[model samples]
Target chain A: MMADAKKIVQVLFEANNIPIPPNRAAIFEQFIKKPGSEAVIRALLANQTELMEKWKLENRIMDIAQQPVRILNATVGKPYETWFDFDQLKWKDIAAFEFTGLEDIGLTFDPKTSQLSGVPAQSGDYKLLFRYRLQEEPEDAPYHEKVIPIIINPDPKSLWKKLDSNQQDPYWKEDDVTAFEPLGDRSILVSSKRGRSHANVGSFREDDFAFKALPGGWNIVVVADGAGSAKISRKGSALACNTVVEYFLDQPAVEGMAVFDELLKQYKTDNSEIQKKINQHVYNNLGKAALHVHKKLIAFAAEVSVPVKDLNTTLIFTLFKKYETGYALLSFGVGDCPIALLNKDVSEVTLMNWIDVGEFGGGTRFITMPEIFHDQKFATRFGFKVVEDFSYLIMMSDGIYDAKFVVEANLPNIKKWKEFLADLGGKNEDGISVALSTANPDIVSQFSAWMDFWSPGNHDDRTLAIVF
Target chain B: MRRLPVYLLLDTSGSMTGEPIEAVKNGVQVMISSLRQNPQAIETAFISIISFDSTAKQLVPLTDLASFQMVDIKASGTTNLGEALHLVATSIDNEVAKTTADQKGDWKPLVFIMTDGIPTDDWQKGLEEFKKRKTAYTVACAAGSNADTNVLKQITDNVVSLDTADSQSIAKFFTWVTASIGVTSTRVEDAGKEVTGLSELPPPPAELNIVV
Candidate 1:
């Protein structure tokens, strides 16, 4: 605390650019023992008034540097207090400490203890100018000053800004959408919500979906995730889903389904030749619908006078048919989304579609790309799954898939699927869950609310569809 | 969780001893404080610092904004940019998560390099190694006229030049960097997309000029 007279003199001498003389400590001790020693020291420095002023100004920085460095931090509306330890300063018998910067932050300072205390009213960096005077100094003496850095961090939760998207735009859609429709003996529920990230920036939710009950006990559900990098991807996604669903509502689709039913029954009897026929029939019908979607997007892009790339989006859908013996689930995907089916006991989970994640280092294959048709793996993208009875058939965009499954491989993991279902059953941080039951009329809204769960960095637009 | 990893490569050579070094320190402090106010950056951005002088050192490892602390750094010795680049590349491999069956990797890292002088070692070797690793964007800044922009050009196409290494210019650069990080964090969270070009970033302040 600079209690020794020798130490105080040495620091002052060094700051004033005065060369230290030999035996200076002994001289200082001898001088302090004499009466009027303070006056004597002051008189010696009186000739160099400029140096004394410089020392006073420089002492503040030196004092702060000599003390242990630590950031003084506070949060808005949070209580905070920090004491200025003046022991490092060379000034002896220090008195009359005052701080000038506390008023800006609505803090109070006690001159006796040299402490600043109060709740910070704002968030910002504050430099407190600490002023102090020597005990023997006159009332008109200049106060020594020190600049201390103080930071006030903001409450993160309050920083988020939610603004509405422009509805006047031609291709604008609602921030959220939900649907419930009966599909033969079963029903499908779908929910899609704009992510918080989008809501914060007033951007559109670039995800869309469509589900319909078709003839011949067939149900079709299609989901699309518009490319975030693309300009009009929302329109592309909407067109992709609608074109596929509109195709299935035609008579040609019914005829195609009839041919598939015949091939399915034949394949059950004979495994080799009939199985190949079943594959060809499913491709001819469902695959045709996918190709037609691509064609429709191109036409729309040309009609809208924008590049086809501007309308980039991903497409995934399932064609479900309920047979007396078992259920047939034929699915196709051309993006990072996942389609999965769970057994009744929830012990087994089967991935029903191909995903394009991590293929080209996190680049997804959009349905709008023409090269996908020529790619060798395009034929393998469609899959057929036959199960005795399943608990849930879930299909979602990358938003939900990336958040729940993380990577493509986890899409088929039994444990991950179980945990995902549990999250749907009220195991999430938000404590919002949706039951897969037709008895609950608010199932759609419930699913929408559940989509608002916080997942740190995964806030892309979420779209989920379940056939239960 | 996908983190928006940011790597800062700063030059602490002998020439940066006085005003430049102190400006750099203040720049980083201000950057950290400003980023803390951003909800998206607070949630996703993780930062690391690599300082290069006679040798390179990772002053800070990959740390989230909530707990990131800046250690004191002094300027001395020659500029060893090669070692700094190599260290950053190795650190990215060791620290960044990769997308596998087990986990989702962080978004491609964002790299920012600032220097006031030319390299004293064969930096091309480090560049070769750096090219193998993927990053969302790498922006290099040549502070003052002594900083060779051509050398930085070899490191990245996104290069900016500052007239001087004073506190005001450094502060403006740091503010631009903070805005860039905020834009990126929000972009990934909202768009599920990565920024691959300089056009995607916010324009630099008047104190900084693009080194085309």
Candidate 2:
């Protein structure tokens, strides 16, 4: 350890900045023996601050400097303070800046007042800049003192609006389709309930296999993923997944494959309109949202408003259908998650050739690109499969990749996959958020983890689905 | 080696009651955030607060700025420059000087004294004490409107006179302070000297209009 430290420190130190003592080896040995010790033995030191500092630093409580603890003042509005006497403030106020990391620190400007200070466990230099936005281009601060940094984190969620019901599930509505006839009776029956718990991934299986009463020789299945970025990718994914399985299962046995073709045509037609709506939504709304936020930010800056940045996000999905001869399907993903069809026997997972229909990630909606309307169908790039018989199917939204699931094809053990999910639950919450939040903190291993080293890793949200 | 004792001797006199006080308050938070971001600054900087209104008051005793809570200062009285100055001197003489290896302290003490009004009380005694102490750290003065420039000049070679802190000048002043401190920190490590800059523009000819 001592030798390692000598090598590390010697390599990093600036030449001629400070002399590296010869006996530093001994000092490093002492350091490694008692890690985090700031003590420098006089015998192993070059001239710097007096040796006494070495002793003082050794006993210092924390390594970094700490800002003084301040008893910040809050704005006063004791309920019945003052009515605007021709608009004159009667109470004292301080702009309580929002501090991050510290729990329960709230910053409020009651009906227009300054911020109040709250208890912060950690302290250091904080910027205390407060700016006032004016109607006009209002002059810049005489100098650039405009950016006042507070020494401590001021809590921003002072008004943590009751987690709005607006915590919306405003994405593709993928509901289970339940229209299959009884295969077990071999004769006739009524409703059949899908036994969903048993599967590779706990999603609804194709009609019969999902049913317990099915004494069938074999069963069928389907898997799908939803794109989260494009305005309507989720809708397209759900529409495709739900419709494909339902159409086949509901059809009379003789008309099964024929019915599937009609459903596909209808899907293509509906998808075209949906795509148009989505394109318009992005072009109309996204630009406006950015403009609104940017204007607010600029005003905030001009008034020395808040020094906070805004956030934006993306999406992806897949869809497939099951049949007696094995599932026949058309799947299309606009942005990232690549798709593949593997043989159910676990023998071969084929990477189907598919066109790259959508532009890559960078919040764009294709306002205008000519000669590519009918020529550039969103579902132009697609993969289809027909097998003699199959056991399982899989689809995902790159989140599985975080666990090192290969995009084109890689069959991870079910148990290993479950463990990966558990690791995910341990690291983050469930739902689509696993998409954006999968960027791991491991710096060393991250570079090698991705196919695109330039991107470091897939930042777009992730979704993974498997069926059996 | 003791930690550098940084005394923020602010003027809370009546003249500095409104915008001035607010700006100072805002500036302090900015400076605190700045220091906290710097690995070396936070470890070495210990801040003491002394606000002078009717009489100089020690709102907060010697503590690291990281831990120092900013008091909502109200400026409603006379400027006790003399008392505040004396307090700073005594603080250095008794508290800072006594810091040692056993005590866990810093190097040369630093005082960032800012004021906007004339001194009505006797500051001569405090000046004498200041002169007597062996110079170790640094003393910087941010002069405000109506501040006695001569009085600030007496205490330190480094002085930044701020004209009326109208709405526009806040960012410029703070930026200068940040730049100066950053450069000063670098210089401290490189040249081993306290680097100080007057409130001026980038070069000599184009001075930033900080002073009236």
Candidate 3:
């Protein structure tokens, strides 16, 4: 057995091109004395081909454990809760898990359980390395390592407060339903309310509406619905509505006329052509106003150290010019808010521009979404109605429409909705249309309170602005 | 106001008689109590309980969560899963309002089914018919080893399995259900859309396995 061991050792040294040391014999002698050492040497020599095949199998098995760990990006100062459970990550065979590179990031990773939790202390990009090995492998076993990029963003909640302190007020209060100011005897009624469900949860109202009466009989009305999934959507909606109204009020009357002049040049010299030009002008101005609001929102987001998308919201506005012949209604909107123009007889109800929705139901384009400027369907398409016989112009967020107006085809039935509104705006004992026609000081309170009407399955912040 | 309708289809087969049945009853109560605390659920979610044994019965009609009361569920006879599906379909049709030219109707309904054993009656046809309706989300749970996962998969991709019908596992399952309801209710109210499918379901406990 000793001779066999010596011969095997000599062959191994020669095959590896290694010169034998003076202590080689002693090492061989020590190895031979160990139990099972001779048997191991014999087995290797007898089955070199089989041993090589087994080594290849082991390599393949190790490759199976080389999957990259996926960790979602985090936001600073928000509860950063994430789990890296072995079972959840499909690493059932993992025996040891180690995390590195999180020491300075204010995050915690449990090596024993692979649980990660922390509110990021700062906002920056970081790379965290995670290493894991198979259950049967030794502590010193080769581990598969994954480098995951972690991005922490500044929390928008604090930044939003810093940018606009007055926003803290409950603007959706039932008594404060009127716009910042009245629009003369035009009988403008504005209502905003936190949906019953949102109110129940103590969440702030996400819908906002504001109207500004421009010089020369131009009325600018804006409505914005903040993205619910966005943590600071309420702020986004408020900022959008206020910014657009302010932009229009600051602009000279010629810029508004330039919107019409640009369209007038494109048409033939005729009365219908004039009307068409007027409609085009209204559409262009509203679209431009929306674009201005988007740019301002992006700038505000940067000032507050937040992603522009965090202030995601839908913008719908109208620049109305009432003429002696009739009222020229120009409306522009991005997202799912509804705008309808009702004729004097109330028989013909026309939905200005239908709500824009993506392939997936809830995916609606917002002003903060850059794609809105590129998508012609949402950007260029504005609701421009040059009507001589219109009585009331109604605009509302999806919160009010989705309750009783949603249909299978996705398009809202305007005729049916008009009837529902007529019922809500019933006649008074004096035979006057008290809700729709009259200018009552309590109209804001009544409209805001009326939105609380119970309907099964619809609990969203409601906003409605009517120009009669 | 459009209320989110949530239906719970429970199994009361003979196999679920003793501790399993009692645990299920307690689990349901836990769910109701948890939902009541969630403002979103309280404002929008409407609860209904349907139990199936040898026959399927509507133990509670669609009622607001604030008024929802837990009833004693008694175990009996074979698992008539087919009847339960039919009852759910019929109940939604009869109770849920449809959007017409005049006004909007209720949002899509959410359904959850929990069972401990294989169905004794034909459930395939009923399940297919139920799928034809506009449903927001659907989840089916196999409560014990005897429950057929293959059959449950046909009803919904969101399927969970419980290794044993112990009190702890049952309680955990109900907790998960409550969390799911809270999430859906919030989405509906916030987004003004009928969001379907499971996006953020609470992870199942140790005794429970999510069926991929």
Candidate 4:
């Protein structure tokens, strides 16, 4: 790496609203020298030109000190950081506005460092977002780029009129099946903020977590994440969430989690008797639809022909059935995720780290496939459980785990607790309030201290389900 | 898993003036959003929108469905079905070239060309270009009220009539397209699950009769 080129890199960061965090700019310079180096380096460029031309998105980095920096999207108006840490994702006054041509939007902050530069390409008025994770202190810099709105196409009024011109899909206004609903016995709290940072995209208020009443003296709390990258992921997540809950509710009132747990196990075992049946059923119901897509994509690949629809995305979800004896939380979906409990009323019974099943090793895998879903052993197992009224149970996707290298890591970072979570990894937070009411430090502080929880990079959507 | 690329070649010509064009436009957006919503639809279906009037233009370029944006198209100019067909074929050729021995990409390109007026440009060159079209794509032309089914047949032996380009017919075309796309992508996704790919596809929709 040349000396001046490195300094210019610093200027790049400074220009983009981020400082050349200590050793990071240097590492970035060296890293971008490989064969696909151009692509790597372009991601680091200050503007959206590189992103626009390459179709690569803007990214957010958590800790430069970490080996591999976590990256998120940069196309939206407000970065994912803004969503993750809205209050801190503030900007200086210039004008009230929005960005355009972007899709997903998010934002978060680093109280440890208090910096913000996330997914959104531009901001409301004029202010570029920036973070100094590795710097001694971000405020060390005298000035920051006030991110400004850029409208390459100003015909927005017309565009909006056309969009609302009564010539749209009936489903256009409906929460596209995968919209969020409430989960657990908890009352839902909903909020909103400008999403996608696009001028056209107004402030969005959505609640993707939901809970429904069940017949058998049980309350069902469900959290399902549509594959952010897959086409029908949203639909798949909706189907899985709706189907699982419906199936369980249909069964006769099972007294306890243990009872329901056993029935679930049996149902899964019975699934094998119809493995062929499940396979054929999946093919019969979803085959033609799936094949229709498969052929077009292959055709797209073959250049024989193609369509304008996208079909790649992944999903992660859970269904919690609250029974008298410890509620049973049944979770099955593609991709690995975070599952844990947090207690608000008392100090104990909150395990933010995932509770483990003695034999379960949860990294990341495709649980949406028919083979996996039909696997009685894997599918029927109640990987985690929750008893008591407690605060809430949190389950997040690879967005956080991937950024934290948590496949093998645990929460509230400490030796005793680490070993404890690893043992209770799959079911760490699923137990009853029978204990933990004895501990100190309230639930708010528990969250207050866990600052690095928002995954570093902003590549995928962040979904956190709080089942209280 | 292999994806089935479905190209929506829409006619944005000035002639698509009133209800028919609006219906077509609304129908396209509905289909895109619907496919995204249908758990039964996304196994491997991907879409691309190509609009043609005087010049064939790729409105939403060839990208995965998850990434492609559905832009608002304004009606203008003369019908250049030939030019659009040529461009679609050319785009397919270029994209297919990127496939390697290590991975099998899109199954087969499904080109749905929707037009009302006759081609104002030379379509023979496109017909010739498609003749050399490796069986990589299964081309299906849908004719509207005044559409040139004959010209469509020349491009691909099979031509589908979208009747009046009315909401109903547009819906029918989208259903067939969605069904066709889903089948192609699903077969490809399920294929990797086994040692052998599925033997064959059920014939296209009943209304989508194959032309000899």
Q: Native contacts recovered, in order, as a fraction for each?
A: 0.69, 0.04, 0.35, 0.00
Cα lDDT tens digits, model 1, A304-329, are: 89999889999999988888778888
Q: For residue B74, what is the lDDT in candidate 2?
A: 81
Inter-residue clash pairs, candidate 1: none
For residues B65-130, could you state the per-residue lDDT of candidate 2 as single tens digits?
A: 345566678878887888887887777776674433223223455566777778888888767777
Q: How close is candidate 2 to the true structure, as a TM-score?
A: 0.32
- Quality of candidate 3's docking, in CAPRI categories? incorrect
In terms of TM-score, which candidate is stronger, 1 or 4?
Answer: 1
Residue A76, model 3: lDDT of 64
What's model 1's overall lDDT?
Answer: 0.84
Q: For each candidate, what's the DockQ?
A: 0.49, 0.03, 0.13, 0.03
Candidate 3 C-alpha lDDT tens digits along B121-171: 989877877887778889899997889999999899889999988888888
Candidate 2 lDDT, A76-107, residue by residue in tens = 12211211121232112212222233232223
> What is the C-alpha lDDT profile of model 4 across A1-468, one tens digit per residue?
345445555677689997656668567767546557555445555354545543321122222112122223233332243232323343222122233223322343444444434454432212224323212224344332222222111111122211121214321212311223344444322111111111122211111234465565455544444433344343344344455455445533233223544454333334666444433333332223223323333344235222222222233334456555545454433344545554544344433223221111222333244344355543332344444454655555443333343333344334433343342222233231111121323433332223112221122333444444
Indicate the fraction of true inter-chain contacts that candidate 1 also forms: 0.69
- Which ranges of candidate 4 are over 4 A from the true structure? A1-94, A97-468, B38-43, B97-99, B135-141, B192-212
Off by over 4 Å in 1: A1-66, A69-157, A265-270, A359-362, B120-134, B197-199
